[model samples]
Target: MAPDDERLLKLLTTAIVNHPRATMKDLAVLAGVSKATLNRHYGTRANLEYQLEAHAKGVLAQITRTAELHSAEPLHALQYLIKEHLTHRDMLALLLFENRPKTPPLENEESYAKDLDAFFLRGQHLGVFRIDISAAAFTELFINLVYGMVDAERRGRAASSRSASTLVQIFLHGSVASAASNLPE
Candidate 1:
């Protein structure tokens, strides 16, 4: 990313983190630029939000790719991604909140969904996830659960009651290989 792009992203992220409901004016002020300048860079509020979502999705995809390289199992890779996301709580909160906008979904959203579906499909093929569940449904469930945990943490609730590892455990509980099903592939 260009230096200006990085600065703009940081400013917008900071504004979102500082306020539950941030506006374009807030981001413009934070970036030390006029609203028109901001608009020139992003076109509109919806466009700005799309850029943010794309940035976040890129971050997630990179993390997932790295985890997949180091981990022996698809589930382990996903667990790593979850833990990394939780570590960046503020960014996740900003991304999650921005995602609720009424605008049409960004291109990055569909790509991200495809990547997640592929991961879930790999897990299902390895008998690590419940095969009965469609890849799309499994992906949606996992993403929603992770986002819910992040929201709970942001709300200052008993967030620590369930760590990312615990969430993964719960997610795979019924689908994990039992004693009888633990035979080597």
Candidate 2:
């Protein structure tokens, strides 16, 4: 897509994130274009949604490229992924809102899952994470924590450094204050 096309799509996505129930006309206004222009570019609301999905895919691609998820300790890598995802808060919001159980996984999703599983397995091997909990379950917990953080931020609850540390601490250590300390050093 042309640079202008990309910018307009981003604007449309931001608009949608801000007002999911907005009409095409409302979106056009938010995108700084006329209804005719939006229609000409996107053809229909469904088409606009399709573009948004494509944009979100591109965002994920960039994150995967730059995150270097394998370059750090498994726990640190997971934290890096969370921070990276949070940087694309608007796109994440759109993607989550559009998520449906029956929706097929994206092409890259399988690889992403494998990478996460490996990360968790590494943590388990290092005794940083509990081996009793399946890696898949741990991954699910990680994703849920990310979603919870995003939701909290969106609801006017600003995430602090302490909030992030607490999240990681909880995931790594559980609720018991001494759980992490008791782990083998």
Among all candidates shown, the one with the greatest lDDT: 2
Taking the tens digit of each residue's C-alpha lDDT, what string does model 2 give over 1-185? Answer: 78988788788888998988888999999989999999998887877887787677677666755666556776667677777777777787787775423344677666666667777887788877889899888878886776677777788785644557767777766776664567664
Candidate 2: stretches off by over 4 Å = 1-6, 99-104, 157-163, 178-185
Candidate no. 1 TM-score = 0.69
The global C-alpha lDDT for each of the candidates, from Candidate 1 onward, is 0.73, 0.75
| CA deviation > 4 Å runs, candidate 1 | 22-47, 69-72, 99-101, 160-162, 174-185
Q: Write the per-residue lDDT of candidate 1 for residues 95-178, one digit (tens) a residue.
A: 777545665566656767787788888878888878888999987897887888887777777355576867787677735557
Report the Cα lDDT for residue 82, model 1: 81
TM-score, cand. 2: 0.78
What pairs collide in candidate 2?
none
Candidate 2 versus truth, CA RMSD in Å, comes to 3.8
My TM-score estimates for the predictions, one after another, are: 0.69, 0.78
Per-residue error for 150 in candidate 2, Å, reads 1.1
Question: Looking at model 1, which ten-residue stretch has the lowest summed lDDT?
Answer: 63-72
**Model 2: residue 137 alpha-carbon error in angstroms:** 1.2
